[model samples]
Target: MGIQRRRSWRFILLFFPLLVFLPLLFSVSELHRNSKELDQDLGSKRSNKFDHIVLGPAAGEGLSNRLQCSGLEALNKTHLSHISHAFNCSEIISFVTVFAVYNSSQSDEKLSDLVTVGNNSYSKAARSMAILNTYINFIQVSMPKSNVIVLSDPASELLIRRNNVSLLHIQGDYSRGMLMLQRIKSYIAFLETRYEEHLQGKHHLNHYIFTDSDMAVVDGLCDMFHKYPDFHLALTFRNNKDQPLNSGFIAVRGTPDGLQKAKIFLQEVLEAYSSKYMKASRMLGDQLALYWVIKSHPSFDVKRFSRPEAFMNEIHGAQVLFLPCAIYNWTPPEGAGQFHGMPLDVKVVHFKGSRKRLMLESWNFFSSSGSDISDMLCLILKSGRTKYDF
Candidate 1:
């Protein structure tokens, strides 16, 4: 019994320490492993490559494939405004206006392929060429310091190169609805490239304006950022409740944080294709998508800018301002009774639908001291086109 008791005492002394320390050892191991995992998560996020978001099975047919073609696998989302704190933006400021123009083949059946001129239908390519030239003329005369980037096909290479404009060749099947929707993805990709360039010390940009080719800019846009430093996104409202906004004119800051937020908003807009408004917005293009996304925000008011003609709202912790279409994106009415010359306050003129003819007329009436404008007129006239006769 004595021997047994001595053996039991020895066993208790030896095993008790192990029993007490084993749990602590396991806990420390778990904590270290967890810390390592957390560090990895933070490290990946700090990279900010925007690769966390993956498009799974979605209703937007060929969206994933098209995005892949644009060298973008995914885009990260920013739910907090404080995310901007992580960006080390450069002090230099520059502005760029982007236009996505796809020169479709003559055999294509898209509505944009054929524009009606009175009783006769003419190829839209001529109009596209003419309008693009005139737009460049206006930009050179109005905002000579701003950069012009055109996302177009190979056919536009000579025109873009000749004008000293930066041309980014785009690839993908721009069929059916993709013609309108794919441009959004292209915009995001261009921004991503620009951001990467900034990191490499090759470029520094401030404001990025994405607009349609048919629009004419009569005033500068860079001052807008100075006017509203807090607002990250600005768009125009049509004053119609059904189609409250037009997606043609969109301005976003080019900083890292601003770019991220803009990407988030545009990504949400792309995802709206699966929403209920898809069918209604089919004929209207991206307006319904823009409306749905804006409405989906936690704090969005359709009438917020009704009285002020311009209003700002905080969405996803970022300020999104809305300007009246009449002021920023003015579209001329159909009849001559409502028609008058471009107003002094109008910053951009939208030659939407049949009003493309009016663009020629307006350009003729508008005068500028810039020699480029005069040269553009000569070119249009040399084509033997008066009143857009094909």
Candidate 2:
């Protein structure tokens, strides 16, 4: 009996450690398995989030092929701004302006030669500053309740701020190429950031109008919304070919479909920049990329406007409504003097090409004459408020 009792005690002691260690070992193994599964789930979610954000084409395939194969519906929704159910076009429309200026050794010389400011020699950056300030002030006067955002380099942020414009500083080396590529990238970046803000419920705009620094608004654009209520996107054209659209002025609706199209367009532009075909074809710059996007994607509801007297001219293609160019994107006739008369209905002036010199001259004339700057420069002078000079 004693020997049997001793054997039983030994068995209990030996088996007790096994009973405890086995359950602990099983628990640890189960925990490890669960942790691995959780990690995999998170990884998959992350991958799915970024699945549609293809900045360029994938390996071993051309961009055209990749675009054809990938269904836009399968694109990740989180990367885009959720269309607000409460969007009201009347109350929310934003004007987006972007400028990129690099300070180089020849920048001053470039500015002085680009636009001569009477006897005063202003640096290229200085002229840019003056132009932007005038543009902002004009917008404020014409569209007092409108939202304005300016995206620019850090050096120009203060200048933009002084004009009571919302400034977003761009960070990068912008000293490369003709800067047109960088401008397009900046536009995309701003759109992405705005999308993020909308997702966070911080932004509520349903429409956006993007313009360049050298343009000024002289009249209200409220009628444009009423006229083009159903249009998704609108772009100005420089000619009838509808080949290369001017990206300087663009209007976009913030609908889901519109945002999706914009994303696809920007992605295609990136692809073109990196593709060898672009190099061979000499299809360089943002304008060519835009032309390609419009050509490639025929289903995007885009309108092109071009009428000599319209606010924005050089429009082509079908379904395009003409706005008076004399008002919206007014550029003086070649060889015309700065004091040349313009139509009374002129709403905006675009100082493109060699016409930039006229902008400074007109601004000076109006400011000195005590004439209402809101009126077209030529109209004010024609009213006999001041004599035309220069």
Candidate 3:
């Protein structure tokens, strides 16, 4: 028995040294693999000049983000500085977003039935085309990259000039653009499916830019993103104080974990939106769900800040006649009939619930030159008079 015990102790002592170094060896191997993979990817991108794609919805007044992507792929002459001080890269890798819900054509003669959202009739496609044109024109003239990837349904079409652009349509017996709050459940579910495919060890995108069709990209997003060589996330501000979760404009890292988190959020958001039987279940639908997502899980890292200025209109300043400006929705203050002379500092304006301020005259681009910008401002001032009962 003493001999057997000594034999066992000897074997254990002999294996302890091997075990101590085994973990260290494994760690070193994994680190080497990761380093090699990153280096190889960098080499590939450098060798091929640059390879990136853009995703956009075919619906909405302007597939603004997509067009901006296209333009960046085509133009952008300046080899600008880093995206931030941390990550180092030439420019943004891709623009991935949902399909737009607007029409491609905006010709006055060929246009007909406008999709009625609330009060006024909106010429669905043309508005989008106008928005798209602005972005494409800017990027194509400025940054021009490699390609674009757009996601949409069958009823949607992907229009891209030159091999520089590409469109990808996705449908699952669900009408995304037309769906309201109740039907929006499926729209959220579809995001999960797409995320799975995006992470299949295939095209490892650098960033995932998520934008709804209703939103527009007026500025050079890629040029702005280039500074963030290896950016973590880029999300725009949400003005909805009523709802805590704002899902309007979001940008995230193109990593497995980030993508999965988005799926989880969308799933929860859809579930919450679908629970209309419980009153609060329909808590602001998408926006409300987004609010909950931030509250529940802190991973979203949501960025909140006003575009140009933080305080343009206060809560007390919101009314029928004394309206703040086009930046906020709802009627204005009775004393104030127009918004032209109003002190306003805003880069992008959003019209929620209320449909009173949309211009009757079709002008989607809103003029780049400040010369026409005043006239554009005046036109908005005139439209501020109309109010929607619904």
Candidate 4:
């Protein structure tokens, strides 16, 4: 009996060590697999480059792909304002044209062919171009994403694919004279339909931003998000005729409820737009709709600024830290064209129509009175991070 007991004991001792090491062995194997997966991802990112990357000579030309684009100083700063405000954003959409007429110049049936974006839709194209351009620049320096949404089917899909950004198409029968709804209603419908998919996209990130294709991002809004995650993602409201809040740029909590609310508001607001008071709003149809809709929902806190510095404007100040106007209407006389010969301090150049032309001209003209980044560097070395850079 003693001999049998000893034999059993000896067997237990031998096998116990193997049992103890089993979890450790599996853990090491799992960790190795995870590490390998991570390595493959990093390798893929390294090889993939932006296709339409346009790094101007003045804007960190030849800098690493991660470098901040545009002439905006790459310094991060305090963005938290009073909690009274929330993140401002708008519909992730596009329009055929502001004009009433419809054209058959293009067809999605020919996906293989190069679709020419006609200049007749110049205003819409320019505005959308600015939005897309800003989106690319924002991704380079800030939170880059693989998915992007463009209203309707665009030929830009191939270009976006080459750049490694996934294109999401917003569908609509924008063919012709339909009286059931107008431009704003169509946009609302698209968001409502796609909201669920958008919410599910959080498998990759926590936040999602939707802006009117007209608005250009000048600086990284990441600062705002970092400061306030719980804050409602709202937008700057416009109270005046010239200075109005654009719902074009919007930030949401990336939830089904938020998407539902946005759609609900858009639908309810269309009726408001169709109302006599809204029609009287004349030039500001969407603004009128938003102003009234916002009033209805106290939960959504939308902010409006009266000055050039609030969101983005042409009003240049020699002493304040400017975000280089994410979205500025630069149609001549009203601060049109680029601020020529101005210091490289301007982070972005928003071209608004004739104003856009002016800004591009001014960009050539917006020269330094001789003090370039070299002089600025000398000054930075002499001083440190201070209001002096303003």
Q: What is the C-alpha RMSD of each candidate to the true structure, in Å?
A: 24.1, 25.0, 27.3, 26.7
Distance (Å) between predicted and true CA of 149, model 3? 3.9
Candidate 4 local lDDT, 149-208, one digit each (tens): 444433223233325344444443343333123446655655565575666673323444
Clashing pairs in 1: none
User: What TM-score would candidate 4 get against the native?
Assistant: 0.44
**Model 1 C-alpha lDDT versus the unseen true structure:** 0.58
Name the best candidate (by TM-score): 1
* Ranking of all predicted structures according to lDDT, beginning with the best and ending with the worst: 1, 2, 3, 4
Candidate number of the best lDDT: 1
Cα lDDT tens digits for candidate 2, 1-390: 999999999999999999989999999999999999999999876444210112222111222211121221212111011112112224456678876665647655663344345455556556667777667766666666667887766654355445446878876435545356556667678767666777778866567778877776766666676767655456655433544355567666676545445555566675665452334232246666666655565554334323242332221222323343444555553212123334444456676654444556556555565644432343322222221111
How many Å off is the CA of 104 in candidate 3? 14
Q: What are the models' TM-scores?
A: 0.61, 0.58, 0.45, 0.44
| lDDT score of residue 327 within candidate 1 | 57
What lDDT score is found at residue 43 in candidate 4? Answer: 94
Q: Residue 371 error for model 1, in Å? A: 13
* TM-score rank order: 1, 2, 3, 4
**Candidate 1 residues 1-390, lDDT tens each?**
999999999999999999999999999999999999999999976554211112222111233311111121112211121113212232233334434445558565675556553334446555666667667766654565556777754434335543546777666434445556667667767777776776777866667778877777765555567778877778888656577788878888777777777777777777785455456433465778878888888667766645536778877665787877765776654211112222234456666664456565446434432323222222222221122322
